[model samples]
Target chain A: MEILIIILLPIICTIMIAAVGRKSVFLRNLFVLIPTVGDFLLVGHLAWQVKSGGTAASLNLVDLSNFAIKFEASGISVYMALSMTFLWIMTAIYSFGYMEHEHAQVRYYAALVLNLAAAMGIVFASNLVTFFIFFELLTIAVYPLVVHEETDAAYLAGKVYGVYLLTGGAMVLMATVVLYCLTGTFDFVPGGIPALAQQSTFMLTVLFVLFTIGFGFKAALVPLCYWLPEAMIAPTPISAVLHAVAVVNVGVFGFVRVIYNIFGPTLYNKMGFGSVIAVMAAITILYSAFQGLRQKEIKRMLAMSTINQLSFMLLGLVSFSMIGMTGGLLHIYYHSFMKITLFYCAGAIITQSKNKYVANMGGLAKHMPITMTCFAVAAVGIVGLPPVAGWVSKWYMMQGFLEMGKPIYAIIFLLSSLIELGFFGPPIFRAFFRKEENNSFNFQQDTSKFGSEAPWAMLAPIVIVAFFSVLFGFWGFVPHGLVKPALSGLLGKGF
Target chain B: MITNSWLLFFAVFIPLVSAPLSLIFSDKVSNRFTALSNVVNFLVIAGMYSAVSHGKLLVLELNTGFNFKLSFMADSLSLLCGLIFIAVWTLTSFYSIGYMSHEHAQRRYNLFSLLSLAGTLGVVFTRNLFSLYIFFEILSVASYVMVVHEESFEARKAGLKYILMGIIGGLTLLLAMVCTYHITGTVDLL
Candidate 1:
């Protein structure tokens, strides 16, 4: 029932939105807001239920032929669902302020809520077919939000996104069909599907290629990566949510499902698929870092940085060790919090001052001290600096690499961290150390539509998400409560 | 919810049927008509989409009394494209109201736009080379009017180049159709 309500609630809310939207803005906003908060509580309740009971909550809707439309909330999925819902709460608040001047609130909010529903479906999906269905739904649901601006650039990026995802979806469908044919099961067992281990190495390898290449379009893995940067033309809220929570997360989350659920860690290790993915992820990490350094726009830079960081999560997951997988899962939560914080800051800056370029953000801290402070904190978290949650995840990932007898991966992780600092550090520094090149803008004026300090609606989420990135750093045990159950749930009790 | 309802099969023809309605109205009225028709088209296609996703394969078979058969399948892939096309066309309808507010020949643009959309819908819906070739031809030719709507030397020049290239491409498609039918004695795409 938790699983059913989690998927159906937002869809119901979206219907209510279309009905209520024409009557009053407040009611429409309420329909969207209520479900987000409600979903977080419900998912939290469900997560707690799983943690305590040691039994996942499952929903079997129907059986189609030999397949079933089902949902289950395991430890890691609960963590992902929690992260998405939590980030959505922030996105909803940030959007209320950010979209004040924008058109199409009915369409935007509806798509946003529907997207929230689709994302929940992705995380809670217990099988490959169910995951694939929600995966495609997610792509379709986010379209209106991404193209909300209706500008030429927005459409261009939307075109790139559509073409890529369409082809990607078809590839994924083919792969799913092939896997179902080979093994006759779509259930995601924790370690590895034992039956899949008996398949020929060549068949499994090709299946891996199909799944990776298909999912890589969304994950923005190097050759399939330009769409992420191009997607920056969307409204800042869309960019933030897509980068942090929904769209890209779906891709990386697909990778998690592929590695753990579909391939399983042990079989994946034996097949040596982990090494190939790690190498690809390493290239993406380093290459995106360099690309990020050259980006002038803060959002695009964040976009590149996102491509870099998502690979970090992938690298960790494919690192072929328990600690590595743990690090990967932790980063999924950490990255969303940190990245959303950074994006919310960027959105606030873009909205308040009408400034977007990093080159112009010099002395920005003087004007928006609160925003830059949040940015600084998130930047520290992203680069794995001490006393932040990012450090905890990165430390584990590096340790996992070393434990696996792969010092080179550890070195690659270190190098990307420095490059990330080179990219992220400058904006925060210039925001403080340098002088405002444009003197006409005045924070004291408070003339913008939002407020003197980027409306509370926007700033609050940024500060809150940023603060969580720090809180998780200090309250490290909280992650263990989740990750241990998740790891053990998949690998069995002894693990 | 899954049904082999006949409306689901011929739903692609809704646009082709409405394309002429745009020519019957003036500029202001045509925009609204286009919007209305597109909404109707969207709702029907959306219904088709629901049926397809729920495991109903919406197929249309035609006996043309020639050496060829016309086959159309609204698989999930085509339905997705159909849905996207309608959404984009609806958005484009709203967009043109603002962007083309000052433009002339709005009626001509509106008429061809629906016709081209019909063409696209046909192309996406068909599962056989026979129908695909016929729809592909409609799409290329209908698009010519849109390119030449400006009615200037450059517009005509570009339109000519576009149509010529489109024709060449169509011919290549025909070549492929011939090869497939000659070999398989049928043009069904699986």
Candidate 2:
């Protein structure tokens, strides 16, 4: 019951906000912010309970003979839930200012909260059925957000988004049903389903292919992806949740559950799923990096870079080594903070200066110094070039890949970093290094006259999440401690 | 007091009924009608989750006559996949409300989309290679109309390429099915 409340609170509040939000802006924003903060507190309490007691708390909503819908707070679920809740809170705060003058406040606030609920449901689900239900709901709930702009282009993007993700959902559904028929249970066991090993290699291979392609859609695997870039038609906060926090990581979460909990390391090795996933991850990593360079829109470039960076987590999981999985899991947290910061900075820039194109953003630091500096910090962290969160996760990923006897992945990582720098380094270089453009009406000049920065609502969250990216670099265990027990769940006791 | 077979039966039958219905109705009526049909299809399949999870695989056999048989296999996997197709189709139907409101021939578009839905459901639920091949062709043929629904120059050209590739695929599948039937003396998979 306690666990269930944590999931339902945001949804209930979403309804409340939608119902009463039309009255006033302050009340509307309050309804949105209160639930997010409330969910964060509830999740924090749940995390404390899990950490102190060392056992998961679960609630079962339905039992239909062999299949049951249950939500549990295991180490992995707790970690993901906490991270998602934190991002939701940050996004809500940022939206308070970003959406001040925007229309459709009621719809926007409702969808935002509902999206958080669906994401938390994904994190807390103990079985495949629960996860699938929430995952499908997520597809529907976020559609309104994507098409919120209501332009012809947004509708077309929404259609493409629906086709791609639901097709992926279809494949995932196929795999789930097949696994249930074979094993007679949908509960996620820690170290793989034992019965799965007894199945024929052909059956196993078919299941793997279905699961991979299904989850790969949102994970942005190379061949089956183009929707993520197109989905940037959404508003910035929604894009942050899509790219940094919720949708993409849920896809990665699916991969984690599939690899560690469904197939486990032993079976994953025996079946050689690692090599298959590694090849896909390697291609997406470098390909998206090079592709990011061609993007002129800052958000689209970040979207492409997101597609690139997300593959690191996938490669980490497919390495099938403990350190690799740890790195992958930790990167989920590290990347969330870093990427959300970058997106927040981008959003602030857009809201403040209306500078959407990177080519026109030269010498932006003269006015928006804090925003550009935060962007630079995040950009450096993404390149893994310094003593930051990205470096820590990258070191572990490289070590994991090398230990798995796949040095090609290590090379891919190194090369993608160089290419990553190529795209992200320019804005920083142009911001501070180059002279400010001579346009008399540039926002930089106008804002410089008043010494204005982004509104406090937006600037605070940007600074906070960016600060975490650097803070976590020095003290890795803040998020890492949450992940260690989950890693051990896959790698046996010592890990 | 619905039996598991009823659920399986309606899951396959509703789309068949809606395909023609989509063609006859006025634009507004047909849109709502197709959207309603999608919802009902999704509900029927969701109800099958219990029986499916109970490990009672719902197999409905249709006797077409003269020792020929067609079967719909509602194993957990097929049922789940059925749910996916219905769900996507439902959302797309709603999306089409906003997307196709301005386009010409709304009735025709609704008709082909609903027809393709039926065909896709057939492909997802069929168990035997013979039935799978048949429904696969049904899906390909129905969706080809959608690819060319715009009837623009580019849509026509793409439709031509689509039909060409589809024929090649259909022929390859037919050859494989024929070879397997000849070698094994049966078309059912397991």
Q: Write the per-residue lDDT of candidate 2 for residues B1-190, one digit (tens) a residue.
A: 2133766667866976787778678888888888999999999889888888888877777653212256677887888888888999999999988888888768767877876787788778776765575556557656776887765668767876885576456545644554464457577864
Worst 10-residue stretch by lDDT in candidate 2 chain B?
B62-71
Q: After aligning candidate 2 to the native by TM-score, how far in Å is the CA of A267 from where it should be? A: 1.0
Candidate 1 on A414-456: residue-level lDDT in tens? 6777678778866875675556785635454554423446878
In the range A1-495, model 2's lDDT, one tens digit per residue, is: 667777788888888898889987778778787778888888888778766666678888998888789888888888888888888999999998888888887898899999888888898898999999999888788898889889999999999999999999999999999998888888888888788889898889988999998889888999877999889888899999765679999998998888877877789877889888888889999889989999999999999889898899999888776667778888888889889999999999887877787876766777787788789878867876433467657756776776787767777877787678779866775674445566421354356532647889999999898888866764554676666666765455422
> What number of backbone clashes does candidate 2 have, counting pairs of residues 3 or more apart or in separate chains?
0
| Model 1 lDDT, residue A271, Cα | 82
Model 2, which residues run further than 4 Å from truth?
Answer: A438-445, A449-452, A490-495, B1-190
Candidate 2's displacement at residue A438, Å, is 5.6
Q: Measured by TM-score, how close is model 1 to the native structure?
A: 0.71
